[model samples]
Target: MISLRNVTLRRGTKVLLDAASVTVNPGEKVGLVGRNGAGKSSLFALLAGNLHEDGGEFLLPPSWRLAQVAQDMPETEDSATDFVIAGDSRLMAAEAEVKAAEAAGDGERMAYAYTALHDAGAHDAQARAQALILGLGFKTTELNHPVNSFSGGWRMRLQLARALMCPSDLLLLDEPTNHLDLDALVWLESWLKRYEGTMIVISHDREFLDAVTNVTLHIDVGRLTRYGGNYSTFEETRAQQLELQQAAYDKQQEKIAHLTSFITRFKAKATKAKQAQSRVKALERMEKLAPVLASAEFTFEFKEPANLPNPMLVLGDVDCGYAPAEDAAAGAMPTVIVRKATHTVSAGQRIGILGANGQGKSTLVKTIARTLAPLSGIVTEGKGLSIGYFAQQELDVLRPQDNPLEHMVRLAKEALPEGESGREQDLRTYLGAFNFSGDMVKQAVGTMSGGEKARLVLAMLVWQRPNLLLLDEPTNHLDLATREALSVALNEFEGTVMLVSHDRALLRAVCDEFWLVSRGSLAPFDGDLDDYQQFLLDEAKRVREAIKESQKEARAAAAPVLAPAARKSSSNLKALQRDLGKLEQQMLELQTQKNAMEARLSTLSDPQEIGELGLKMQTIDESLADIEDRWLAISEEIEALSS
Candidate 1:
C-alpha cells in the first residue's frame, strides 16, 4: 500500500500538484486521469522515487516494491529478452547463491538454497517471462533480437513487459496502452484483472482504463478527487457535480446582482442611505465565485473538392502484407497474408477495422493508403477521389531538425499546388484548430512529445481536406480530452473515414460500420462495434461447444480400457479415475464460467465492457483449450497403461 500526503510537485514555473492526497490500497486498481499538461507522469515519477517532490512526502511500506513504466524508454544496446530478463535480478542472485552452496556441498547451506529458490519462485520464473513476452506481442523469434532493431513503439512494449515482469507490491504505468494493438491490450487487461498486487495506471485510453481499473483518480486544477467506479461512471458523476456547482454559482451571482442594483438605485436617497450602505458592505464582504473556464472548442471543416464515386476505395483479391524479396522467382505466387479481401468504402462511410494484433489490420490500412503495394490484387481508385492517409508511423516523416511551422510549410508545399491561395493562413488555422497556437507552433518537431507530434499529423491531414481519410491508430498518444475533441471533430466531418484503432470507445463513437479483419479475411458488420462484439461472443460459444464435444469423445473412447483396469486394481485405479473425473468436472466448471461470460458480453453495449469481456473470453478459451489438451493426453496414457 502507498499513500501521498499533502504532496506538492512543481515543474519549473508550473505547479502540477498542490496539497494533493491519494491512497492506493493493496490489490487496488486506480486509473489516473488528467489533462495532458497536468503532470500525471510527474506524479508517477515522484511515487517511483525517480523525482523528489517539492513539498510533503509519499509514504509507503518499508518493504513495498514499486515499478513504473516510463513514457520514454532509455536507449539500450541489449536484446529485448535480455532487457526483460534483467528484471529478475533478485531471483538470479538467489540462484547464484544456491549454485555456490551446491558447489561447496554443504548440507545446511544446500537446504537454505532450496528454501531461497522456492521462496523466489525461480523454477516458474522462465515460464512467467515467456508468457509476459508473448502477451506483450513479441514473437518467439524476436525475443532475442537486439533492442536497436525495434522502433520506438516496439521499444515501449519491451519496457511495458519489463515493468509487468518485475515483482513489485505496486505498479505504476504511464500510458501503457499507447503502443499496444488490440490483442496485446486484451492480454494486458486480463493480466491486470487477475493481478494480486496493487496498480496505478495513467492512460488516456477510456476503454483500457474502464477494463482494468475499479477506481478513478482525477486531477483537475491542482485538486485531486477520487471516484469509486470506472471511467464512464466517474465521468457521469463528475458531470453531475460540475452542473451542480455551476447552478449554485449562478444563484449566488443573481443574488449579488440584485443587491448591487438595490445599492445603485438607493445610494443617493437619504431615507434608504443606511440600507444602501449596509448592502454595499455585504457586497464587499462576499467572496466572488471563481469563473468557470469554457471548454476548448474543436472545430474541423473539410473543404470538399468535387464529389467522388460511390466507392471511394476498392480492393479486388488483395494480398495485403509486407512485400517479399524482389529477386525471388518470377512466376511464384506471392504468399497472401490476407487473402481474397475485397471491400468498398463509400463517400460517406465511417468504417473501423477491428482485429487482434499481427492480424494484418495495419497491413490492410497501408495497402489502402498506397504506402505499401499489394502482392497481386488490383486496387482501384474511385473517380475524382483524393485520399488523406494518417499512418501510425507518420511521425517518422517529420524532419527532426525542423520546427513545427517549418514542418507544416513543407507538408503544405507537398500537398498544395504551385500557386495555391491562402496556404499559410490555412496552415495557421489548421494548427489552431488542433490546439497548437502561438509559440507551440514554433517548437522544433524533434523536441515535441509523442502526443504533440500526433496532433500535428492530424492537423496536416485536416489541412489537406481529402474526401476520404485513412487513419491508423490516430489517437495513440492523445490524452482523454484530446480524444474527446477528436471524436467531436470526426463526428462533424462530412468526408468518409477508414480507421484502424484499438480504442473501442473511439471506434464506437466515430464509426458507423465495423470491418472485422482476422485470420487473413475481412468481414463487415453493418452496425456498430456493439454488434461486432455480439458476433464475437456467439463465435466464442460455438468454438467452446465444439472443443467440449471433442474432449467428450476422447474421454468416451478411453472409458472401456479404464473400466478393465478399474476391475483389476479397484482401489488405486478408482482413485486415479476419481482424480481424472475431478479434473474433468473442473474443466466443465470453467467452460460454464466461459459461457456465462459470453452471455454477459452479449448483453453489454459499452465499448469498454465489451473489450473487457473479449479479454475474459480469450483467457477462458485458452484455459479451456489447455485443460482439454491435458485431459486428452491423460486419457491416451490411461489407455496405453491398460493395454
Candidate 2:
C-alpha cells in the first residue's frame, strides 16, 4: 500500500534519513524500531505526507487512504466519544445533506439521499459505531463526559480510537501503546492481527511489536534495514549480522597491519620496492568499515547503609485513596479503596502491583511514599527508612524552564554529601549514564519528550541513593532500549523496590513478588504476572463449570414435579407450564449471554476495549434484569407446590 524509494530526509544539517528504501505490502504489519532521535517519528511524518523529504520519492497507490494517530490533537469542547465520532465527518456530512433533502420534500433529492444512505450503510452505522465504541472501552456514561476532563494520556487513547475508526488503507501509529494499559495493549494487538489494511507502527514496546508485527524495519545512522519476522527474531538476526560485521572488520584490520609492517620494512630494498608499492596502493583503495559504537553502559551501585530495619515501610489496617482537600468539608472520605491490607516492604524485596485500571495502584504507592495519609490505618516508618518515590505523574516536578545541566546541578547540590568535591563532574557523569552527554545536557527539559523525562527522573532517583524506592508506572513512557537499561539497573540495585507497572516483561525481569490490587483489596502473589494471569483463568473456568452444573441439576429436579399436573388440568396446567418454560428459557438465554460477554471481556486486552466491553455488559444487564424478574415469579410458583 505504501513504499519509499531511495528516500532521504534532512533536518537542518542533520541527515535523518539517507537513501532509505522500504516496501510495505497490503495487510502487512511492520514495526519501525530505532533508538531515540533516530528519526522514527520523522519517517512516519514523511510517509504520512505531513513532512516533505529532501530527496527520493514516497509512493502509495492512488486509492490508498492513510491515517495517523496525531501526536497533538486540536483542543475542542467535544466529549471522548464525540472526538471519535468526529473522525467520520464525511459520513456525518453526507447524512446531514440527506436529512436536509428529505425535509425539503424534493423527490429527486430524496432519491439521491436514499441512494447515499444505502451506499454508506447508514442502517448499520449505529450498530457498527456502538461496537467500535464498546470495543475501544468507554462506559455509556463516560461516552458523554467532556474530553476536557481527561488527562493527556487518556486524550491520546481518544485519538487512537478515532484513528482506528477511520476507513483507511494504511495506518501509521507512533507510540500507540504508550498510554494504554495491559488490557488495551492486548486488545490493540488482537485488532491489528485482524486488520485488513497495512500498518507501520513506531513503538518501543518489544512484546507489542512481536505480537502484532510480521516485519521489522530498523533505522540507524541514516540508513534503513528490513528484517523478516517479529521483534525477537529481528534482534537475533541483527545481533548475528553485527557479529559478522565486527569479525570482518577485525580481519581487515589484521591484514592491513601486516601489509603496513611489510611496506615499512621493505621500503628501501630494490627487490621488495614493487611489492611494497602494490600494498600501499591496495591500502589507499580499501573502503574503511564504519567503526561500531559501543552501547551505553549503565551501572547503578548504591552503598548500603548500616543499621537498616527489617521493614522499610509498613501499613496495618490501612485505607488508601485520593481525597481532594477542597472537598474535606463536604464529608468526603478517603474512599477507603484499599481496605486494611497489612503490607510490608523490607530490604531486597521487589514487589509488583498488578490489577485493572483505577484499582488504587497509584493511591497505594502514594500512601507508602507518605505523600498521602491513610484513613484509620497505622502507617509506620522503619528506622533509617530513606524513601525515593517516583510518582507516575510526578515528572511535572522537573522544572521545564531549567535545562538538564541546571536540574542536574541542583539535584547534585541537594542530594550529594555536604563537602563532596567534583560535584559538577559527578552530575555530568550521572547524566551521561542516562544517555544525556555533552550538548544534550544543555537542552531545556521543557523541550524533552516523555521518554526523556522518564529517563531523567530515573537518573535523579539513582543519584539520591535511597534505601527504599517507590516507583509508579516507571516503564510507561520508556522505549524498549531504555527500559532494558532500567531493568538492568533495577535488578542490580540492592535496595527495596515497590513498583506499579503495566509492562509484564519488565515486571518479570525485575520483580520478585506480585501484589494484586483487586476489588479494593490488596493481595500478595508469591509468583510473577504470568502465574497470576494463569491462576485467574483457571479460577474463571472453574466458576463457569460450577454455574453450568448447578443450572442443569435445577432443571432436572423440576421436571418430575410438573409432569403430573399437566395430565389432571390440561389447559390451566399447560398455561402454567408454558409460563414456567418461558421463564426458564429467558433465564437460560440471559445466563448464556452473560457467559459470552464475560468470555469476550476476557479476550479484550486494551483499556478502551475493556471499557467498551463494560458498557456492552451494562446493556446486557437489562436482559439480565428481565430474566431475574421472570425467574423470581417462576420460583414463587414452584415453591407453592412444595408448600
Model 1 TM-score, all chains together: 0.74
How far in Å is the alpha carbon of 86 misplaced in model 2?
A: 2.3
Model 2 deviation from native, Cα RMSD in Å: 14.5
Candidate 1 overall lDDT versus native? 0.73
RMSD of each: 15.5, 14.5
Model 1 misplaced regions, further than 4 Å? 70-85, 100-107, 140-151, 244-306, 326-335, 419-426, 525-635, 639-643
Native RMSD of candidate 1 (Å): 15.5
Provide the clashing-pair count of each candidate structure.
0, 13
In order of appearance, the predictions have TM-scores of 0.74, 0.74
For residues 1-643, what per-residue lDDT tens digits would candidate 1 score against the true structure?
Answer: 6788888888898999899888878888999987778788787877777788788878878787877675666588887777776677567777798789668755445545555665777656766776787777776678678888888888889888888778888888888888888767777887899888888999889888999999999887787778999887887666546546766456446546755886899789875554465455445422231112123223343455456566787888888876547887776556566877888777667788887667788888888888888887799988878788988888888887887777778877776688764466666766887777888878888889888888888777776768888889988878776676576456545568788988887786677677888778988856666566565555445644775678677765655454444334434545556656866997989989978975775576665555555556657767876666556655654665566
